[model samples]
Target: MPETGYMAAAVAVCTAITWALRALPFAVLSRLRQSPLAAYLDTAMPAGIMVILAAYTLRGADWGAASSAGPTALALAVTVGVHLWLRNAVVSILAGTAACIALTALAP
Candidate 1:
């Protein structure tokens, strides 16, 4: 077994490192909050993220196969319609997922 003094020193070093790692983000983000880039990202990130998500979700879709693609396309339409009508992302996503599940299950 290691000596008590050595173990205590090791633990102290580890604790300090862990605390620094945890605090670093707050320190960085606090500075970033005043940056123009951060302001731009705050305004632009949501739409950009949504676009990326949509592209990723549809990227692998079998567009040539109507039977496989129809449900996904319909679900996307439902998602957009629900979001437009309700103006709620959570509700729209849930409704779209449910529609996809039901449509795929019913697809022959």
Candidate 2:
């Protein structure tokens, strides 16, 4: 077994590295916030990501499976509805995922 002093030093080093890694992004993001590229990304990336997500989720769905809780279509609808209602991407994605899982799980 390693000595306590050695373990303590390792833990302290790991903790410091983890903290620095977490803080580095915020430090860099402040600089990025002033860039035109960042501004463009801020406007463009979410929509792009959402489009990709929707395409991926729906790509495999059997559109002809007409049901009240049609998983993929209903999930996409829920995602869009939540996004429109709250204008919050994280919440919308999560809500959509939850709706899809619940609907799929409960479907006959």
TM-score of each: 0.56, 0.44
Taking the tens digit of each residue's C-alpha lDDT, what string does model 2 give over 1-108?
999999999999999999999888996688889899999999989989978986764654546444343776788799899999999999999999899888988888
> How does model 2 fare in lDDT?
0.84
Task: Compare the candidates by TM-score and give the number of the best one.
Answer: 1
- Cα-based RMSD of the predictions, in order? 10.5, 9.3
* lDDT of all predictions: 0.88, 0.84
Q: Candidate 1 on 10-32: residue-level lDDT in tens? A: 99999999999999889669888
